[model samples]
Target: MSRLTQAVVLLLFGGAILRASLTDLYLRYVKEGLRPFLIAAGVLLIAAALATLWYSLREGETPDDHHEHDAPASGAPGDDDGHGQGHHEPRVGWLLILPVLGLLLVAPPALGSFAAGQAGSVSAAPASDSDYPPLPPGDPAPVGLLDYASRALFDDGKSLTGRNLRLTGFITPASDGSPMLARIVLTCCAADGRPIKVGMTGKVPLEVPADAWVEVTGVYSPHRAKDPVNDVDVAYVEVTSWQEVPEPKQPYS
Candidate 1:
């Protein structure tokens, strides 16, 4: 890896970051809050590449004026050419191409069921005195999975009772074939994503394949179970109807 290769690698990596940020493709793997940082970092990397290119070119053009006196006292081990201008040869820098190719080509996907299984599942612990805000005005109120989980487990379903709520998320089936509608919440980025899941009871929703996004209309079941793993309550929803829906522009909550 020469300085030229280093610059090219930087250019590729930075281009991938800038492209992901500008095209809205980044939302799939990172939080929108990172937009500014991504842009700044990308621009800096691209600048480094351009600067390296300019230096390389300038170094190439002045060979006639070059002299052994220009060479540093101790040249690099292989550079017997005492004129002092040879690549530093950053062999390890080649490793940067792996992430560059990953981001540019596969563009890697958000973590899904497999990751959820490995991660410690989130469950809100039962709280007898938890206070919850009133559900916003709607017949079948639109609610988020995180909010619903908190209410169901801590507030004893006070906010959820008798209200048919609409919750949208992708499906992840349990090993026993029971389907769980799950939403991954990202605090900073997809690397830190965690799954909030609820078991759904409905013939139609169960039929939807894993990773298919859908909107579920349902009422929360009063009966909640204490999950031993996280010592948090796991809520259940009885779906009245469901339909496949386009994935939201920003999938993370």
Candidate 2:
């Protein structure tokens, strides 16, 4: 650990992975095709922490080339016998600088609505071919809370019946607090995120905020419900316009 604290913990973990992959904060924890492999692993860990701090400052300016290639070890420069050249490292490697100072000071937002209220169901993916393909002419059209919850739960809403669509997510209240419409789907990162939700039902928008970020406008409402933490089926929409936006810059999906 002490190669100058492993080159200052690999240059603060490669400058917090090159300041979160040089910016949209690495889409809040990966995906966006993993930003060029996280900028080539933060430029090869800051070029191996600057070639391990230039070979630990050229072995501290060659102290007589470590007494002409090691041998005279007797314990003096901070010693505990492990041939100390001022040793003592394992203080748990300074807890790896607390996740590189929480990824260089506080980078932690995405995965909202408390991870979709601690998820149990709603990660959508079923509808393979119960016959889809229709709503794209755009009156509202945008769609995609996992393709409107797999076409409202396996095509029962048949390509979202009278369309209107438009969805953008984040707001996961339900369980009587209503207002669902989530989104989080990342298959690889954000530790395998999940969320997808949907449920808004006609004119719903109880003043947003469960991770805000909205943009509703809706119509596909076969009104299904179950999912009391995994009974599954949950899709409805009927919203007819909502607003509050901003969070996107790849907040997953």
Candidate 3:
């Protein structure tokens, strides 16, 4: 392919990434914190393409054929000398368009229940020196699903008991055995996301299918005594109430 064609490919690829980052579609693939880096990478690629086109036109960018030794004279369409520096660009390069088009046209959804099911064993509370803090003053103290799980599973449910906290997440059927609250936790991006879950209790009924977003309110229900060997992260919440809600802007925690 001509230098112009190569430059065009770079331009289009960069522009696609830039558009994805600007519109927050990038969240579907990567963490929100990567926005700045994504934008910078896209801009750099566009600049490189523009520079290539500018210099190629100025007749100063591409080096003159300062062949140390004469290249074997150009051969027939299908021929090649020992150093087959074929003039045609490799066809494999075209495969790159798959991701660009997928991002541009389809805008795939974030990793959800399907991914959660494939995740490995449950995650324990990350090590910490201090005790879990008390819920800040509020009627239904808003909290994350992972946060509640950690406190319940590892801390013997001390911090969570009697505190009417609120947790929002997508449904993961049978948190312990029945439909319960859950959220996907990402160590970096969707590729590494793991599901954190909490069983639900109390008077309200839960009828949502897996992946349905909801906000649940209640205190933690007493479960089997915490065992050091077996994780109780699948602790239950006495759901005084809950309601379906729109999914969050960033689905994974």
Top lDDT prediction, candidate number:
2
C-alpha TM-scores of all predictions: 0.80, 0.37, 0.82
Roughly what TM-score does model 2 have, to 2 decimal places? Answer: 0.37
| Per-structure clash totals for the candidates | 0, 0, 1
**Candidate 1 vs 3: which has more lDDT:** 1
Model 3 local distance difference test score = 0.72
As for lDDT, the candidate ahead, 2 or 3, is 2
Range of the 10 consecutive residues with the lowest summed lDDT in candidate 1: 61-70
Q: Please write out the lDDT profile of model 2 over residues 92-123, one tens digit for every residue.
A: 86798899898888968888888787885555
Superposition error at 141 for model 3 (Å): 0.3
List per-prediction Cα lDDT, in the order shown.
Answer: 0.75, 0.78, 0.72
User: Any residue pairs clashing in model 1, and if so which?
Assistant: none
Model 2 misplacement above 4 A: 15-25, 30-48, 60-90, 97-112, 115-137, 143-163, 175-179, 183-199, 202-249
Off by over 4 Å in 3: 59-89, 175-177, 203-205, 224-233
Mind giving the per-residue lDDT tens digits that candidate 1 earns over 1-253?
4556666888898898888888778898888888898899999989998998688677763422233434445545745655656534335857879888887887566677666555555755443554676788887899888778878766768778989899998888764667777888887988788888777765447567888889989988665554444555567777898899988888887
